[model samples]
Target chain A: MGQATEDRGTVHTVGLGKRYGSFWALRNCEIVIPRGGVCALVGPNGAGKTTLLKLLTGLNRPTEGSATVLGQTPKQESDYLAEIGYLAQEVPMYKQMTAAQHLELGAHMNKQWDGQLAVKRLTGLGVPLDKPVGKLSGGQRAQVGLAMALAKKPKLLLLDEPVAALDPLARVEFLTSLAEAAADAAGELTVIMSSHLLSDLERVCDFVVILAAGKTQLSDEIDHVLKTHRILIGPRTAETANPAYTVIKASHAASQTDLLVRLNDVQFRSAPWHVREPDIEEIVLAYMGQTKTEGGVQ
Target chain B: MNWAMWQQHKKQWMIFGGLIAAFAVFAVPTGMHFWHVYQQALAGCAAAADCDQLADQLFRHGHDANIFDITKFAVLFMPALLGIFFGLALVGREYNDGTNLLAWTQGVSRRRWLSVKIGWTVAITALGAGIIAALSTWWWRAGNALYLSKFQPLDFAVQGILPVALTIFAVVAAIALGAWLKRTLLALGILVVILLVVQISVPTYLRPHYAAPRVYTEQLVVQGNKNRDHRPDQAPVPAHTGAIWVNYSAVVDSDGTALNWVNPPEECSYTIEEASTRIHNEERSGGTPDVYIDREGGPAVHFRCLKEKGYHWEVRYQSADRYWKFQIIESVLYLALSVPFVAATYWLVLRRDA
Candidate 1:
């Protein structure tokens, strides 16, 4: 019932910058995300994640450089917006309106709405159609917002912590729906979700973009990032000797020292030293720390 | 566009329409009753023989039902409220509900969004104003016809329509203020302050001044013999007191004599052969009549009578002289007040962020 998979334009930027007076919300940030894949943007509070999303959605204009959504200028093209579904951080829905009303309003305005897909998604998420959004719980409200965004059947989905406020059960259900929705198109739908929940992003994100202090610390495939980085635990004396390894970061707790090392060369050998794959959380924190030490967040 | 303007705002429209309808139903009958009461008071004064007593009664009657009391306060207040509500809710609700952002992001430009909002508000305001105007006009027509026979329906132009237009302008201006401010309560505060200042200031300091004639009547007796057929020397009649004599005419020959010479542009003077002073109250019953004197201090052919009634006056002149100038001046003033509102609304909408 839908068109076959085709290549959509990548999310590309060149020296994109956003400034609020003297404070740089995001500056000198350049990154590229290939088409039709899931990318998670992980950042802490006040790290300009929301500002970056606003700029990418054209809700806010960039102070310098340029960013494109599907090869169209985000600020100028309204047609591109129709193809891009955005769920802002707060999910700005009419409070007095019901979930069904929000969906209906969105469907009426967007020509690309797929009624069957929307119905299936709503039912799957157990979102009450008859309940007014204001009367629903926070988790239900977030689900309603997600349903409205998905009803448009957009080519690119930009979600800002879509499940952050959800309960454990609701959060899992919400992410499952996202995975199913993306799977239905056979990886054709590209999703860029920003969240602080690394474990939740680990379940669905194929790519990870870690940002610290308004700049990109790391942006790569999840598998490549985990494979290229390792957590090495060795003696404090050996760590202090600075063995032959690209040390991303090293910290001492009691007598054991934890080293986050980039395994660019695996020739380093030390007695009683163990190497294990770095978890996504460790990799993100290491990059965050590195950015922090370099004067400020990028 | 249709969905955003109509469906989204349907409930608000229904509430506004019901309120306006209720106001109209209430105002029309009350306005009619006041008009009737105005007539009764005037008739009661006219029945008295003592001129001073009659004048005193007329003054009290005017104090009770002057233009400001009968028309301005009674008829214009409801219309102004309707206008304010129309303005406060027009764009204030959209910004509050966050639906405006949804509409803006959905390909509706900010200009188009504001246009639709202002268009709908103006349409509703015009309808509400038209209803109030029509109802008030009908009530005033019946009341004026019954009581103040001299009152013309065209007087509604001043007492009714002008205030309605002013109130409507206030409403549109308030709505624009609401959109620019983006908060209903703040907009309402600003609107109230501006309206209070305008209402107090415009009527007192800036209201236009209109020129009206003054009329004075006097009785004069002649001492000359009636049978002699002689023309006694006519004394110069002084000009009417406190009035400028623009024209002079005489009703000549109580006995069917055509005084063709007294008909044209020439001015005349008649003598006070005998005089009687009748005082009804404390003031002089018949004040000293002004004599129109010529250069030689001789009586002229014609004399003008002037009577002052506050801003308006009655004279030997036609009614058109008083009515036309007042109407034109008020209309121009009303038109001038409306321009700032229109210009401000346009500028605010053009520069407002989506």
Candidate 2:
């Protein structure tokens, strides 16, 4: 096995594009994610979030541009794949193979497997290793996939909706175990996960990269995104529209109006509309809605 | 990783092994009876002045002479089923099971994956064919010894070897077909069609003529006078009598002219005198000679003469040039078919939209 390095893991894609015949799934998307922190890639369905992850993982190639994982081209440097753990969106598993058999196969094939860690995780999760994967419930299967990914002790982890099939409790437990595993791995674990469940992302991700219509709407530290973005509610008749506030989006329901305003707007004042701190969910939904208005949803 | 792949295919391998075992067990006894009958026929022929007479006697006595033929027929037919099964399952099972995706994602190059598959299939098929050939050969050894004196080694050689070789060839062709088709049922159908076409066509249309026996007889002419007899031309026209019976024949020329004869006449004219004499003899002696007269005696005729005069006729049997060319064309067609299948698989696997 190669010695682990201390360099921060980074994913960089420049003008990355994907198209299926006449329809473009993603186009000219440029984004850079810094290492050592969880980045939540949030988007509506068909926003090309899955495509970007696949391109980054080397499962698919871009049509126009290129992507780099840890400074190596994903397609060219498949050896680097060993250092990255990926849980595909569908999580295809050998249904006939038992959970233990799947793990054994993974251990045999993966260069970074830590058997003890996998056993401990499976045991803690109460997953019966001997049970056939097809016989297991959807949540159980997802747990098995997670255990396999975490046991690899990867430097980078890319998961596509890992908990989409799990129930609420299992989803929480899976994410909690993931966070603990990341911490136990000494923060060398850099994870990039896409999810429509913004709450789950908000719970586990430290950074956020919002994608809409196959383009990056915004990407920044979670804290910074939440702090800089605010939801304002006030009277529609209030003629005091401040110049400091950039009204990212404004929608009226009944008499009162709700405005998702960027705090960076120079005209924004501490007076008038009641300003409330926006959570990650609001931030993601705002960008999604704005992108939708700019370009109709795919 | 290799072991894991093998384990994944273990059940399939076991099934193949069981099939081979069953074939061996069923075939051994029948094959042994075939060898014993052939051995007795050869021994009887050696002890008699006329082998054909001995063959007639053996046949009349109902001495299980058909056992050898039956065994040979079974040997020819049984392996074709094995070939079809092996070919149909080689790659189709993996694609059907979706385990191929797992292997592909596990860092195994697509080329390597395909190579392993083809390698394993060819190796196992070859092994099975070899075992069948060996066991059949062993069981037929006694019959072969018995027929040694009655039949030429060449006859025995074709009887024993050609069917097995053909069966193996069909199996290989089936593998290529299955790989190209990507479906077991379709591949098997194509294989059966090919086998049926070959079996039905080869016997009637392409049977080699020269495989039959040759008989040579000459007329002794006692000239009317010693002086006239002394002259070569006056030596009663030196009547020659012979019959060249051939099942198939061919003539090849450097100028790209080729002629094939299937089931040619028993006797042919060698010269003008022979032709006239053959007609005369048919009228007078009631025996007609089938002779091919080459007036030009060009390279084409000369080549035909050379081949017909050879010891082993089938070795020079060139009647099926068109069929051989068709086989080559089919090979190219199979190669062409593989391209789209491979391209489609790669395209689906690496498509940008997943």
Best-fitting candidate, scored by TM-score: 1
- Go through the candidates in order and give each one's DockQ: 0.22, 0.18
Give per-residue CA lDDT, model 1, range B1-354, as digits (tens): 556467566777898688767766766666666567656765775676433243233324554447424654555565457556677666666666655555555544456666777777777776666676667666555343333322233243434455556656677777777677765667878887876776666543443234433333233222222322222223222342211222333323333232343332332334423111111121253443332322243334323321111111112321333444554565466557667765676676554433
How big is the RMSD of model 2?
10.0
Give the CA lDDT, 0 to 100, for residue B188 in model 2: 79
Give RMSD to native, each candidate.
Answer: 10.8, 10.0
lDDT of 1 by residue, A1-298 (tens): 1122122236777778888879999977777776778899887777777778778877678889888777677752447667777887766677777777776776656667775667677777677888778888877777777677777777778888787777788788778878887888676688999986466678998898878788887778888888788788887767334446677788887878888877766676745677888778777878767423342322
Fnat per candidate: 0.21, 0.18
Native-to-model Cα distance after best TM-score fit, residue B312 in candidate 2, in Å: 21
Please report how far candidate 1 places residue B37 from its true position, in Å. Answer: 6.4
Instruction: Identify the candidate with maximal lDDT.
Output: 1
TM-score, B chain alone, candidates in order:
0.54, 0.51
Q: How well docked is model 1, in DockQ terms?
A: 0.22
**Reference-based TM-score, model 2:** 0.67
